[model samples]
Target: MINKKLIAPFYERLSLVLIGILALGFIIVQGKEILDPLMFGFLFAILLLPVSGFFEQKLRMPRSASSFLAIILLVAFVGGVLYR
Candidate 1:
């Protein structure tokens, strides 16, 4: 036999969790357009990190110089892809 006392709080907590999940989902859906580019830029920066580090360490370039060179390399690579 199940106890009546334990069931009430359990149901209450479960409902709260479900409501929280639904609310989070609603917020993400509402902000999709604004969030998409920010996420893309973040991933793009991640992709550039290794190439930037190589320029900074092996080539002994300054941080800003290396990063700018990395951006140039990225542009050139992208342009070549588009051309071909």
Candidate 2:
């Protein structure tokens, strides 16, 4: 036979998880436009992190200068590819 106490907690936790998922889905749907560029910017920053670190550590450039140089390098790379 199944234990009733064990079943109740399981259902309760499942319901809470389902509700949380629904809430997150609703928020994402509502914020699609606002979230889109922010997410891209976040991803772009992550991609640039390594290049920036290289300039900062190996070349000993300042943080701001390294970040700007990394951005320019990436833009030039992308532009070259698209222009070809």
Candidate 3:
């Protein structure tokens, strides 16, 4: 026979997990404006890593120059999309 007592702890743990998830979702929603640009910059930097490495390694560009080029390209790309 199944015991109610045995399942009680599992239900308590599940409810706590659900509540934590809801709280995290609420915080993310409230902070979207601040989080959005930060997330975009993170993703954009990740996308540019390989290109920056190429410029630095293959083209013999300096670290600062390669990074600057990557940022310039990112801005240009966004501008192009907005312009179109």
Candidate 4:
């Protein structure tokens, strides 16, 4: 049979990992309202970075103008989906 002493430490480590994961999940749930929009905006900006670069480099738009255009495009796309 396997040594019980060796198995005990393995179970202890596994339980610690499980507890840490549960704690993180609880914190995320509690902060969801504030975190959700911040995360969404972060991801949205990442998604738009390339398009904004294209407008600035290829289309010769200014930095602010390119960023504004990217935002306008996103709004229009979302509006279209909602309208449809």
Candidate 5:
């Protein structure tokens, strides 16, 4: 007998485990295709680190201000890339 009260939590946990396994399977299947974008994002983040440091340390700006300016610059650069 599947008791609703007792089995509900068990089913929920099983569902979550299944979902995690499926996600892992998908990643394994598509793993090779994922590295390029991951590396690109990593390098881009490394490049941004200096600009953030410049704003925060050299310019004595707040983190929020630095972040906003960085985002704006990134958007502009992306727009330029797309336009060209």
Candidate 6:
């Protein structure tokens, strides 16, 4: 009772399900080892370093103050996006 006309649609649906299952399995298996925490730390440190130095060299504010300012700016930007 299998209709020949239905074969292409059936294969297309099967291919999509297979690809999704593979992607889900990969994420479940490698979510931690493949992703980065130290990479984030390094990037954040590099970004703030210049801003902190700008304060110390030009404005004469302490590193801690510059870091706080950067964090506040980041929070404001993120909050604006979320609110909108």
lDDT of 2: 0.96
Model 6 accuracy (lDDT, Cα): 0.79
lDDT of candidate 5 over 1-84, digit per residue (tens): 875654568789999999999999888778958877888878877878788889999999999898778778988999999995
lDDT of 6 by residue, 1-84 (tens): 875663568789999999999999888678765557767767877877777778778998887888888777767887999995
Best by TM-score: 1
Clashing pairs in 3: none
**Candidate 1 off by > 4 Å:** 1-8
Model 2 weakest 10-residue run by lDDT = 2-11
Return the TM-score for each candidate structure.
0.81, 0.74, 0.78, 0.73, 0.50, 0.48
Clash count, predicted structure 6: 0
Q: Report the C-alpha displacement of residue 78, candidate 2, in angstroms.
A: 1.2
What is the lDDT for 58 in model 5?
92
Task: Give the alpha carbon lDDT tens digit for every residue of 1-84 in model 2.
Answer: 976654558789899999999999999999999999999999999999999999999999999999999999999999999995
Residue-level lDDT tens digits of model 3 in 11-74: 8999999999999999999999999999988999899999899999999999999999999998
Candidate 6 wrong stretches, greater than 4 Å? 1-35
RMSD, one per candidate, in order: 5.2, 5.0, 5.1, 5.7, 9.0, 11.7
Instruction: Give the C-alpha miss distance for residue 36 in model 4, angstroms.
Output: 1.4
Better-scoring candidate (lDDT), 3 or 5: 3
Per-residue error (Å), model 3, residue 70: 1.5
Least accurate 10 contiguous residues by lDDT in model 3: 2-11
Q: Lowest summed-lDDT stretch of 10 residues in model 4?
A: 2-11
**Candidate achieving higher TM-score, 2 or 4:** 2
Backbone clashes in model 3: 0
